[model samples]
Every structure is written in C-alpha cells, then in structure tokens.
Target chain A: MESDKKIVWLASYPKSGNTWFRAFITALLNNGEVDINNLATDGIFSSRRLFNEQTDLESNLLYDEEAKQMQGNVFNHICAKAKQRHLFVKIHDAYTYNSDNLPVIPTQNTLCAIYIIRNPLDIAGSLANHKDDTLDDSIDFMNNKQSVFGKQEDEVNTSLQFRQPLLDWSGHVNSWTAKLPFPVMVIRYEDMLADAFETFKQALLFMGIKTDKQQLETAIAASSFEQLKQKETDYGFKERIRNTSFFRSGKAGNWKNELTSQQVSAITSQHQNTMAKYGYI
Target chain B: MYYYRGFGLIIASQIMLPELLPYTLTSTPDVHISIGKTPEKLTAAGTVHKVGYAINPNEYLLQFLNVANYYAANGNNIIVEPLAGSDEKSVRLFLLTGVMAAILHQRNAVALNAAAIKHLDGVVLFCGYAGSGKSAMLTKFIQNGYKPFCDDVCLIQHNDVKAMAAYPTIKNWENTFTGMGLPIPSTDNKIRPNLPKYATYFHDEFDTDALPVKTIFIIHKDHIAKSVEIKKLAGIEAFAEVHNNVYHRLQIYPMKKEAIHFQAISKLVANINVYQVTRSSNTGFDELFQTIQKHL
Candidate 1:
C-alpha cells in the first residue's frame, strides 16, 4: 500500500451539496470534461457491495454491529489496494463508534475529511422532494434522533448502500466537526453556492490537492448548476430520486417558497443552537 | 452422523443440519465432512490471501477467525476444525454456507449466490447480492404454489442446464414471515444473533431433486422505480451480471482458477436465459409477483 493514496472523506447530510462537490472535483480531475456516470473517486462509504468485495462475506448475513466493525477493515483494505493517489469516499454516516468502541471510519489511513452542511430549512424542502414525502415529514425526519437511511427490517435492502446511522441534523454536523480524530474542513452549502470558486478552492486546499487557477476556474464553470442540470436532463443520473431530477433547484434559499412558515419554524426550533451557530437564523 | 442431500450431492456430516432435506436413500457421499485437526496457519503455502479468512491454496487451507477452520483436497473431502468456545450450530452454518461453496468451486462447479424455485416452466433462479430479495421472492413464489428448490445458494450444472438444490430452508427477516401472515418457526440460531432474520425451514414443499433452469432473474431493488420492470439481458452485460453473482468468486483469484471459472460462467450465460428484474421499494409482493408471472 502506497502512502500517496490520500483517503479524503466527503461527509454530508442527505440532499446537501455533496454531489456538487464531487462533480466539481471530478471535473477538475478530468480536465473540465466530466463523465456523469464515471466519477473520479472510488465509491461511496456505505456501499454494501464494496464491503462484500473486500471481506469475501455477505454483509447482510452479519448483524449491523458486526457489519460496522468490519467497515473500518474494509476501508483499510481498499486503501491498501488503491491504485490512485487520492480517493474521495462519500459518507452519509455520522462519525460514531460501533459496539466494540471503534470508529466506523478508521483514521489510521484517513488523510482528512470535508463536511458539507446545508441550512435545515432548505434541506427540508430538498429532502421532501428527494424522499417523495411532505415537507413537514422531512422536517420531522431531520429532527428525529433515530433517523437512519436504509433501515429495512421487514425485507432485505437490495440497494448498493448499507444502513447508515444519521442521528439528526445537529448530531450529523457535530459528529464530523467536534473533537474529530482527523482534520475536517467544514464547508457550508450556502457558501458553495454564494462563492463557488473560493469555497471549492479552499476545500481542495484542505485536501492538499494542488491545482492551477485555470483548472479551478474550469472545474467551477463545468460544474455550474445550470450545466449540471442540463447534463442530468440529457442523460439521467443513477442517484436521482423517483421522477425527480437529482440536480433539482440548486438555489440557496428555495425553502422560503417551498416550506410553510410553521415548517420553517419547526426546523429552526429543532436545530436552533446549531443553526444559530452556522448563521441559519 | 447425519446424511443430507443438497446440490445433487450426499453430504455425511458429524453435526446435524436440519435445514437440508433428508436423503432417505443414498450410496456413497460425494462430499465428506468430519471433525479433524486444522492447522492455525498453512506451513507450505502459496499466494496467501486474507479476507476475514485466510486462504492458502497451495496448502488447501481456509481459516476463519475464531469460528471454524477448513482444509479441502481432491474436491471430495473437507476437514473441519471448530474453534474454541464456538457452538456446533455456528460452526455448521459456516461450513454449510462458506466452506461448502468453496469446496464446490474447487470441484469446478458453477455455483451461484442465488435462490431457486420450481416454476411451471422450469427452475427460476433469483440471483443477486445478499438482501437483494432473492429469498423474499422465492418465498412469494412458494406461497403462490411453487416449490422451493433451494435458498441462499444454487449450483448450476451447465452441461445439463439444471440447477442443483441446496438447503430446503430459506432465512428471512421476522417481518417477512409476519407480512405473509405465516408463523415464525422457532430456531435456536439466527443468521447472526444481532440480525433479526431467522431460518425458516420448509417441510412439505422441499424439492430434493435438481430442476432444469428455465430462466435466471437477477433481482435489484430500485428506489426510483415505480413499478416492477423485467428486462432481457444479452451479450457482455448478461455475462458480466452472471459473473458478478458467482458464489465465492473471490476464491478464483487465490486458487488460481480464473480460467476454469470464467469458462464455466460463460457456458452458463450461453445456455441459460438471464434477465434483470428491477423491483421498486414501494411495490407490493403480490403486484411484483403478478408482473413476473405476466412476463413469464
């Protein structure tokens, strides 16, 4: 295993700008000609197939606790065998420990992480559209501490990803940023939309990736919201929700129009302290 | 000792396997399983590979962590050494699932990680990654008057276009049994203790004999898919899909048997009708079954 295989974490809550960040990095890596299908990184962190491929065992056979214990090993195995110098793994799971008191994402080979957060109000609208639920339901889900993605007990979860524990909006944000084992660069989704070039460049610098000004500008231009939405319109994205575009309304504050006043108040009330700290209010 | 018939082979085991359909009449066992001493590490080994378990093909050793250890030779005999403090059920489960699959692979059989049911046409194999609704789909077909041929693992005999039946029982989550209004069978063991799924054994609807495979449906769960859609797969895509679903494919590398495995899978793809069945998350089992029935 080469030390040059830089393992950077692309951490984000659901419906955040994680995909946009990945698109920008992919475009930059591909010299501004990005393939929507083939990304620059290896894969997402919660992929069940990757765990099976790495461990030679069916992950679904094991208990959730047992599966979490092996996740760190899976990451290490992938890092050891990676051919690329830098690997960006997108993770929806909050930074947490397994039953054995071990970090789900091992920090032994991890270089750093970039946590992307969005305003709870805006996220509520996007999440509602993404999940095909009501805005109020999405808000409640974000506020619920027991929120988990892919938590299927009745039937087998056949998707490529595994069950990810996302404690809540605040818990998710704090999990990555507070008392972290490795260095993490917190970039707001609003900032990315406000100043794409500066925010993206800062994120790249945090990952220790060196690039020229032309490359940065090209990546930003190539991954612009309009261009991305156009690409999605031309050839559909695999990650898109049912009958909905993945690049749906990349505006910063569409919640004002989409969310009701009561819904907005509920989101703010649930995530008040964290939202206030991040200037969401 | 208990004798069981599964995957067209008679297995003589020291431990009892209630999951396998009883082999009433049998001659010599094709595969033998017995408790024996297993080395912690292979001494004379070649190309050692570690993935939860360490496999050294030169020494014919497959060692699991603190559970059970296995060594196979001549593709007909396997020696099992259960680790300290490991219960017989846990050891048996590992042997029946992983070790048995590995032994079959060594024998040059095209074993797939899938479940099968004896449909009206022929055996319909539901192949995909674990939790891809293979067992769930098989259960639905079973409830609809189809007999379960095998669950979790299916061995494909390419020469005759038949699928060899393994265990008669299908492991399913608690909710699945409840959803179908079926009583949960009591079992001392789980797939794993923390996992809510339990082993549901079938007594009357078990088909011990092998069935000719009519179609292989690779199931995938699509969150975005609104309805059940079945698409015919052809060419490289079909081959790749089947290859991906091959049981114990990782053994192909450490065992240095890629050529034979590829040849076996290629023959299977040529002979079998393969399709990709995408089921939406929200689709009811009855509706999905009807859609599959319509396609058939």
Candidate 2:
C-alpha cells in the first residue's frame, strides 16, 4: 500500500491555539505577511461547503450521524486531490471512532497531527467569551462529555458548518495524544506563549517544512496576539461568535484573575487526571 | 411514469416530483428518469471513490448510502436503483437537487443558486449560501405582492439571458415558516423522515414563464454589522458574482462543461446588474426589502 502522508491535522478543542497556529503558518507561507481575514490552510474539518465540493452532494440534506460517517472518506478524497505538499486541515472534532468502529480520520494519508492542549482553567474563561455565555456555563460545558459544537436543532440544521463532536476537555486532550498509526505532536498553549519561536519551529520541523531562524521570527512577530486582535478589531472575524471577539486574550494563566476559585476547582477536579499528565496540575 | 416541466426541459420520471409544474402538453420529454439496473461501477469514468460515486465527461453516478444509487447520462436520462424500503420522497429530493443540477449543466444552462422574484419585465435574483435569508426574503417579497419565480435554483437560458421558472415549490426549514408568521403544513410534506425541512407548494402564484434577467444581489449577514449596506459590483467583480453562484460549479469540470459554463456565465454577466448586500444579523427584512425595491 502506498502510504502517501499528505494531510497535517491541526487538531484542538475550541479556544485552544488552533487559529493562532494557522495564522502563523499563513504568515510563513506568505513571506511573513498575515491577513487574518484570509488565513492560509484548508478550511476547518467541519465545513459543509468543503464536503459538498468534494462529494458533489448537498450536505444539508444528510443527517448529522450520516454526515459524520462520511467524514473519513471525505478527508481521504481531499488528500487524494491535494496539489500541495502538505494539506494542513484545521479540525476541532475529537479523535474519535465512527459508527463503524473505525477512526473518523483515516490513517493512510495522514502525515502528522499537531494537537494543541490548553489549561482548562484558562480555557473556561476564554470559551465563555467565545461562546458569549457565562463562565460557569462554559465550565460546565467543558466538563460535560456530551459536548459537541455546531449541533443545531433538527429544525434549523442549515448552517454551513458540520457538527463537531468534542467530548469533555480531558477526553478531547486524550483523544489526540493517544497512540495512533501516525505521529502526534502535543503542544501546550502555555509553552507556545512562553517560547513561540522554539515551539512553532519544532512543529514545522515535525512536518518537514524547512525554515530559518529569520523566517520563523518574522512569522511569529506578524502572527502575534496583538497583531491578530488588532486586525479583528479593524475588520471583524467571521469565525467570531455573535458579538464576541475571537481573539480575546492570548495570555497563559489568565485563570488567575478571571476564573473564580469555585470555577477553577470545578475545571481542575473534573480534568485532574489529564491535566496532571500534561503538567497542568 | 410522471411528466413534469422544469429547467426548460420536459422531465419524464418514474418517481413523482411534486415540486415541478405538471406537464400536460403532449411533446417529447427532454429528460427521462426511471428505475432500472445501474452498473455497480463506471468503467470509463475518470474519478471514482469508495463513497459510492463516479464521474466522467458525459455521465455521473451518485449513491446515497442505503438509500439509492443514481446514474445520470448525457443530460437526458437518470437511472435510479432504490434500496428496499426506501421512501419515494427522499429519492425525489436527491433527484431535484444534485441530479437535476447535473442535467441542467449537461445541457449547458447557466443555473444559479438563487431565489428569483418576478418584477415588471424581468426577475430580481437574491443569491447566497443557505441560511443567508434568501428564502425569508423570498417569502417576504411574495407577501408584499411580488410574484415568485423560482425558489432555490434559478435557471438562466443561453442567447436570451432570461430566468426560467422551473419548480413552483419553496422548501424551507420549520423556523423560516414560524419566523415569517406562517404555519407549516402537515408532517407528510417533510422532505426527509429525520429532517425538519418541509416543502411548500405555491403553484397558484408561480410564474410558469421566463422573464428577462434584471439585477442580482449577493446577500450576506454579518453578526456585528450595524446596518444594511449595498454596493454595486462592476466589471470583474460582477462577472465573479455570477460565476461563483453557479449551481453545479463543482461538477462542471468533471463533466467537461467548462466552455459551456464559462460562455453562459460570461454572457449572463454582460446583461445583468450585480450588487453585494450586507446586513446585520439582528436587522429585520423590511429595510432590506425597501432598499432592494428601490433598485428594482
């Protein structure tokens, strides 16, 4: 079998460093010129438009479960038709097995996966802002194993996004970091903030992208949080939820001031095991 | 078999498509849909996938897992093999969507993903992705005394640059009906067993003729937008708006209809006025209606 590893999965839970990393890549691809509006990458894994384009079928007519079942094939088709060396796909769906007990993302065409993990403590506050909900509600959502994004009511399943099944925060973390057929590189959000050049360089090297220190520094500076947030302020981000800013704060340990003691305890206790494994505890 | 008139063609189908106008005139059907034996795979096709489909220059095959396998050939015939116990409504829905689009593209028609409203001597088209309030605006326009031309797919004929009214039905989610203060019909009209979308037949108000293409509005809703803004697109921008709205653009290349699609879109763009309309998500339809009414 020809194992053509063409797809690089940028896997993460929402509010993790997925978009930021994609922005950095976009800058690198464009000689350190970042246009936040038009980020460079294959779109999100859950785009209904991409599915329709690849399969030549209307995704709106299919049920969510049926759509989920076809994702593996949809991705494989994407890889087969890819013209670039690496097809960087941003995915929020947890690494999960489908109804047929097979991996939702096929292993044959996968090159590598960059799984971005963040402290659930900071994530609760950031997620609250992104979802335009209460912090406590966001905390509860992170702890709920049944949590899925873009799952609308049956009456209005007309969104351009597909349903992304994201289990609880810990489950989301473990799903990507677990043993898999292909290589998985886990990057902590705090680490990326502490040493962005080193962290991003390591990820790019893992995907066999050749870059020098100067290019890395340029891309990092261009994709910095301040730059991204300012761009969003000037021209709104389409990915932003209703009335809420997408790039709220890129600070690590933001939970120190934002999250209350009760909220911190709630996130830590629920995600203690996985949090400890990733050095969050 | 049942016969219907749609997309400037007479369609004879074994399955009943309630959305299209009934064809009572005795003439040769341009397309035929029947249940028959379809090859498990296409041998001469260029692209084939494990997801149950194949495509080539003249033929396209689609298999809805556990539902049916549809084979369309040369813009004239569609062969359907329904799985046992499959319902007719589901089969008919697929036929109207992907199969019918393929048929139109095969015949070199410039079909757009738009909703058209009949004006004085032409049709005003509202084009957008799904959930961009196209249907809501269409329903609103109908209530405000504009005649409905086409609900989802608007077919523009070549040489004449006119918008042909194909199907007389409008399909919308349950929320669209309740949002418009209209009642959804019985559950039997649901498009699929598990989907909450229903088909509303508006045969009485449907214009069964073609109208000249007038103006096109590419609509979008920005959540943070404060007010509605409309801009006229000229030259390349106007051309792109029509090209981007092609109903079956993805299949054009695979079917070797690029010349046909490009020529049709190029010709249509030269004859129509295109505008981009942006509105806040919270805004009501009245402002947009009034703004577009001025342009019309």
Top model number, DockQ:
2
Worst 10 residues of 2 chain B by lDDT: B45-54
DockQ of each: 0.41, 0.54
In angstroms, how far off is A41's CA in candidate 1?
A: 1.6
Model 2 lDDT per residue over A42-154, tens place: 88889988888777778888877778788778888888877888889999999998777888887889999999999889898899998889999999999999999887765
Over 4 Å off in model 2, which ranges?
A: A1-3, B45-52
* TM-score between model 2 and native: 0.95
Would you estimate the TM-scores of all the predictions? Answer: 0.90, 0.95
lDDT of each: 0.79, 0.85
| Positional deviation of residue B222's Cα in model 1 after best superposition, in angstroms | 2.3
Interface RMSD of 1: 3.0
Residue B279 of model 2 has an lDDT of 83
- Quality of model 2 by C-alpha lDDT: 0.85
> Which parts of model 1 are misplaced by more than 4 Å?
A1-5, A154-159, B24-28, B35-38, B42-45, B58-90, B119-122, B178-194, B203-208
What lDDT score goes with residue B265 in model 1? 72
Candidate 2 to native Cα RMSD, angstroms: 2.0
Q: Report the C-alpha lDDT of model 2 over B1-296, residue by residue, as the tens digit.
A: 89888877898988888888888859999999999888787778475553556777677788887678898988999999998888888888888888888788777777898988888888999988777778778888987988888888998787778888768888788877777788986899899987888888877777767789899998887777778899998878888877787886777777777787677777887888888889876668788888777877
